[model samples]
Target: MAQTTAKYHCLVTGFGPFYRYTEEENPAWLAVKPLTNSIIEDEQNNVRPIHVSTLQLPVSYQAVMDVVPLLHSHPPVFHPSIAEQAARNGVARPQKGYDFILHVGVAGRGALRVERVAHKFGYNMKDIYGRQAPVVETAPLPVEPEEPGDVPEEVLHISAPQIEQNQLELAEGPEPTPEPIRPKRGFGPGYENFQEEVYSDVNVVSLIRNMKQQNFEDVYLSMDAGHYLPDFIYYCSLAEVIRSVKPYERRRGTQVLVVHVPPVGQPLTSEQVTTALKLIITWVCSELQSIDDTLAKERFQ
Candidate 1:
């Protein structure tokens, strides 16, 4: 069997509006500096450099074009466009060629609570758009598979007809050769389960899709005014992309890229940055070690 070989290079794009975060000295393009500039190391002193890049695009459809070329899976024959250049260097004309593209930005979910924050109470529960959201359904209790003596009920799959119709209507595009840059997952030694907090936030993109009829650029610019996404949502999106590459190895892949986003126009505290950096390191190291472990099990067999 031939092993896959393609260099993994990540292009991390952050937002640079008219201004930067308050704690920063320079006109910073990114909100979270920890995510952009970093070095990954091991006990043996082997190091892999992580490269970061930022973009300054007006929150518009043009921003979406900046990353689309990078997503080509194959020959990577870039259809050169001026927008690509503007995306990469804020002015350079974008030319064909790039391995992978990643972008992170902030959203204005807090604005939803701002008006309420001024009131006597903490804040109202409506989203940024002022619509009161209903109580979200929690995860249902997992029902274990039937025991050996138990009779299994007939399987019932609730499929969507519209989805099926869409599938039929969907057309295949040019296939790009898959170059996987799977990122590692899980926490590293020490700082495990650090300051975990659960909060409810809507995927504003979904709302935009409903309102604008699936215009991501409109939604992105409107919600992500400063262009930073919530960290967890960015992580989830990153994981989804990786899993799409090799669904079987979803739990056991290295090179997991987590795009750490921050609130608009602010730098995270040192402690917060430290925790994020530590978790990323742990994931990379664990994934590297587990390659042999997964190989021994021969699940790929």
Candidate 2:
């Protein structure tokens, strides 16, 4: 029997200490630290082909905007422009590009929340520096031409599927030799007439059900991701996934998820939070593997 290669790549991020929370450690980063470069094993004792890269993001609105574009272009690895800074800090880049993005933050509440939806707009909140965020801000999404004539000639020459293919290729970068025909998940930019909200395109309901089956206590789904950075990051990350990958490939491309954990010494212990993080990561990898296997089977058929 031959050893199998890793099949999936994931990026996990936690916020650095900020504001009033500065006195205590951020539970999100602490929980995620042990998972970096760790391989999860399924029940059969076979290693799940998943590689995780972790990053600690600054607690600033500007930081979110600056980092997201870099993530979109070359995830797990900083863009060339920031390579020096990333290296100086000993940041680890993924062996390859990432297939999933998970943002973890402390909710200061007791339960572990697997967020169901991320609102498109954010409330007026102040960052660490006392800088104020706009009353409402929309994450950038792909825009279609209003008129047929407005379409770019380069884009017009390609068929609908081909256009999607091209977008997928550009998003994944030149290296790693892109996987052919993965299922992409699309997140609609919510309602135009009403307040916009982007739901988690990943199968959260199934994930929650699976968690319950595992007998993990206090794990529940919540519609609100939060009004602050967790919500902002989720919205931006999802928007980037939409802008970067095609609709068909987005489902299989990169799954964006945000997990809100209670602060330490509240109702949950640090160990419990770590357990929840591991559970979420493992489930994500399993789902991606299923998707990959399905696509591979379809190709042969």
Predicted model with the maximum lDDT: 2
Residues 187-262, candidate 2, lDDT per residue (tens digit)? 2233243336767778888888888888887788889876788888887787766666665652455788999888
Report the lDDT tens digits of candidate 1 across residue range 1-301: 3323322333444444423333242222333345443334343423233333334333222232334333333323223543464444432122322223334444322211100000111112332333322222234579998775575343234358866775666645455578984332221222132232221122333333343442212222131111122232233323333433455553332232323334533344333433443333333343444453467558557
TM-score of 1: 0.34
Structural similarity to truth (TM-score) of each candidate: 0.34, 0.72
Off by over 4 Å in 2: 1-3, 43-47, 74-96, 134-195, 247-251
Off by over 4 Å in 1: 1-10, 18-28, 31-38, 44-58, 65-69, 72-103, 107-285, 296-301
lDDT of 1 at 55: 41
Cα error, candidate 2, residue 55 (Å): 0.8
TM-score of 2: 0.72
lDDT of each: 0.33, 0.71
